[model samples]
Target: MSCQHEESMHLESISQSSTDHSLVVPQCPDDLFVVSQAVKRVKEFYAKHGEIKESHGWNHIQAVCDHTRKALLALDYTIQDNVVVEIQLAALLHDLDDKKYFPNTPPGEYPNASAILKEFGISPEGSRKNSYEKIILMISWVGCSENGNTVPKQVKDTDAYHLLIPRWADRLEAVGSRGVVRCYQYNQEKGLPISSPASPRPQNEEELWAKYATSDKLQEYMDRGGTSKDMISHYYDKLLHIARPPKDIVRNSYLEHQAESSSKDLVEVCLRYGKSGQVDKEYIMSLS
Candidate 1:
């Protein structure tokens, strides 16, 4: 089949399989084929394994993919089709083996992504496969702001921009208006509070993880029968502190501004609500 015809068919298949229609297939035939296959596999995997998570659902995947593409476009360097494919696949399957969803499965194996690539007939020993694994694993480690500051030595030594493109895109998703909603959804699912004025907030990533990372520690908070660290405090402790990209990297200024403004506005409303027991009407209007 002609590449155009194949692209059209894949686009139709993707649309039928997913509610999301925003996926833009790459023009390169090989890239298009791989990415289309990856999208279908991801949908099936998520549906079968975990259905969809509250914050890290299919929607989140789509958003990250979109951000990754845009980030690549904004780059000062030229991106190759193979590199784009690797980055896109990394975005698609970044959370495939997440410990949160598939606890105790294994570490650093990327079994799900590996399986999908195997189905695509990619060689296990190929450099492409190696790059895919590295990028996806790096993305998995790029958590909220507190932890994101520490890039693993191996990742820093690789093609830094290739990995950083997806890492920054994923991190960018954790702030802004979309981010606020995700935080609320996650906290609500966990039965955590919106705010806890009496409790002290975590000072850094270590303390943050110690208090809420493990099942045992999370249960400890649950057993307390009250809010220790509220969902809104998530912004104060982490989201608000998201690092700006260095001068060398082409920053997504629009996203940065939205994150800053939206997060600050949200914290302001939450603080006022705590004291006055009412939503901020003016803030609501400003959003409109």
Candidate 2:
């Protein structure tokens, strides 16, 4: 596959880096420096690599950040300003070194992420430095389940330690309308077909896995001795569970709507043929 590293993301600068921290309604200063710095670094890293996938790219992080803040306001959970900053930072940098984009890289060992954070002076002894690392690791859904890995040192919340607020907030994207779009966009962008009729199988299974296997979720399929050689099987195995009606992990009304609508989107995409629309309409009709 030809990698396009020269395209510019035109990512906006971290403007929220200078807000007033005490303000509770709109934006806060707490995020201005840390979150802004992290966001800046994220875009810079992707700009350098140029092989970004839509599913796990800077845009995805931005959406996660938006959803995180929306969930915070909608839920009205009493969290400190400092903690909110950490959560926001995690949401922004969650996929900096996602396996999907960096197949050979391991979670928690993402050099680009580490370098950027370190560049921003996110040191081990910094107040929220350690907290940021833990939050980032929590987003490692693959690492958490595959090898029984865990972030032992956690945040102050005893009630929602493992299931942290940001954890849910960030994941809000994976199941809703946005998530559905991202899933299909991911396949289209990669030129990977969702089904036989959607696009012809690539001649290189070994190469395909090389890129797709980097995703922690897909890596799990291989780790468990699973034989799902294609991406659509991923939806059958996991993505469908992200939405509501058929499932219900989202706890708030806003997220509930997103999840409900996204599931419908998933079905719509399932019905869609990829680059070429050569689906077996007669067989599809038979199923109905």
Candidate 3:
């Protein structure tokens, strides 16, 4: 099937599914000349990067745009010309850095992808920068693989909630430390505030024990337990596992040691910041 056809099918399935929040198709305004131009630029940008055979290729951008639009619709967002344009821009540009700089590596070790977007005038400082910065920052937060970066409580909570509800929590968790840390850092950079008390400082082995001991946390959050701590814990554990490497690799040689080590380290950083009370719970939970 054609890529467009496949995209349409995916969108239709998303729209028809009762689990997804309802969405309204947006109408383009007659005077949206600038938006049209932005879309054109975005198309060109994707075309250029699409040649790479990796996750950040052209079709990936298209898929993200489709998913993003549906996500916005589910939230009852208006998807105005500018919002649509920004979403497209953010989706396309989000992984530019990863594609160009870290294609072979996990997304955690790479620097901010927004720097390039900003240089190209596609970011907050550009002409139509309304929510552009926030959007980019949100994408960055969700995309990052490191910790110590603080995210607004709301964004953190929203994202965490989405992770659990849609069963993407495991994937998000699987991103391990690097992903969670980056997400937290993005949230903090945006000045998003924390809604709850900071988690206590996790001691030496406490971090590891807390994770295995609280595996139930995952189930609790999935089952709609009151607080977001469980989700946070689950994410933390996943990140930790990714960042650290197992000692008995020879016995389990199939494991990607480097990737596993990176993942564990990434989660460790997230735990540090989270215990320091830097991450925003509400924001992570609010993701659609």
Tell me the lDDT of candidate 2.
Answer: 0.50
State, as a TM-score between 0 and 1, how close model 2 is to the true structure.
0.64
| Per-candidate local distance difference test | 0.58, 0.50, 0.41
Q: TM-score of each candidate?
A: 0.69, 0.64, 0.37
Q: Write the per-residue lDDT of candidate 3 for residues 211-271, one digit (tens) a residue.
A: 4424443344435522244334444433343233333221122123333444544445445
Model 1 lDDT tens row, 1-288: 665455445544654465553374454666777788789888888778663565877777888887665555445554555666777777787777766667667655667767887777654566566665665565565543213344555656754645655666676666655666666667667677766664334444455445623334333433453224666555545554453434344245534443445454445545555556554455534542
> What C-alpha root-mean-square deviation, in Å, does candidate 2 show against the real structure?
11.9
Maximum-TM-score candidate? 1
Model 1 clash pairs are: none
- How do all the candidates rank in terms of TM-score, highest first? 1, 2, 3
lDDT of 2 by residue, 1-288 (tens): 111111011111222342422222233444456666666667777677777865667666666666565555545245555555656666666667766677788534766556655666664567657765655565554232232222233333354442343455454566555665665567668766556432222234343334322356434654674334345555544554334322223345555555555555444444453323543334333332
Please count the clashing residue pairs in each candidate, in the order shown.
Answer: 0, 6, 51
**lDDT against true structure, model 3:** 0.41
> Where is model 2 more than 4 Å wrong at Cα?
1-31, 141-157, 161-170, 196-227, 245-253, 271-288
Residue 179, model 1, lDDT: 64
